[model samples]
Target: MEEFEFITQSADETSILAKRLSEKLTRRDVVTLEGDLGAGKTTFTKALAAGLGIKRNVNSPTFTIIKEYTDGRLPLYHMDVYRLEDADEDLGFDEYFHGEGVSVIEWAHLIEDQLPNERLDIKINYINDSTRKIIITPYGSHYVDLCKELRDESISH
Candidate 1:
């Protein structure tokens, strides 16, 4: 239930923060993103992919629901559940959640019941044009430590 807040003045800043976070991620890590439209969820994911050493373009899997990139330091599973009106459907989510990779879910609230008990939840809010407030809530010890490291890195930067 620990929370960390970070303010970004621009998309570039947001990306930098996301990339920093990605460096702390590991296999089976789940990162859930919540925000309104144009809040830069996809932008953050792209930067996270870059940090993981993924060379491919990372975009929202709005229609596909899930996209997998395995050519990185660790596999990246990008999921956008916004289009899933029926969250009851079993899409083998556990396979991804427990897979040897990091899973980044967009609109995770839609599949709240399916999500693991331990995960990192991130809420992005638009403060104004070109500014965003990122609130990170860590639900497990690993995530808590990860946030602490991220905060320490941010401070030393």
Candidate 2:
């Protein structure tokens, strides 16, 4: 298993980390964000969206199962599975997950079986009242390369 870990003492730090990580993302990347509520997952994604040149506000798609934003370097297919567990919710997930755009899924564990086996997985855990721990796992050569790039950038800047 390929793993890279980072600890952020504050929400700002977590956002910064995500911004930096976004630089390595390209077309057709799948990023799975998994964590408890208030773990700063949305904060991190906001920074990532910023890095990708997305000007629209990135919010938790709790009500809407997925939100598509094209005003970025690449299209962003953002999904939140929090409210998608209902039997009536019909998610045409394949079109977005397999599309050419970059996909980021929040509460991804809910539909983990549908996700690509080789992708970037991010887990955010509350370290305490003022800290958060983020663990990033890369499952394939592409993500592994991205991890190395992120490591180099993290160390140098």
The candidate that achieves the highest TM-score relative to the unseen native structure: 1
Cα lDDT tens digits for candidate 1, 1-157: 6799999999999999999999899999999999999999999999999999999988899999999999999999999999997999999899999999999999999999999999999999999989999999999999999999998888898
Write out the backbone clash pairs for model 2: none
Candidate 2 — worst ten consecutive residues by lDDT sum?
85-94
Give one digit per residue, the lDDT tens place, for model 2 in 88-148: 4446776776787889999888887778888899999998977987889998899999988
lDDT of candidate model 1 versus the reference:
0.96
* Candidate 2 accuracy as lDDT: 0.86
Provide the lDDT at 40 for model 1: 91
lDDT for 47 (candidate 2):
91
Q: What are the runs in model 1 whose C-alpha is more than 4 Å off?
A: none
The number of residue pairs in model 1 that clash at the backbone is: 0
Write down the TM-score for model 1: 0.98
TM-scores, one per candidate:
0.98, 0.92
lDDT of candidate 1 at residue 35, scale 0 to 100? 98
lDDT (0-100) at residue 94 of candidate 1? 91
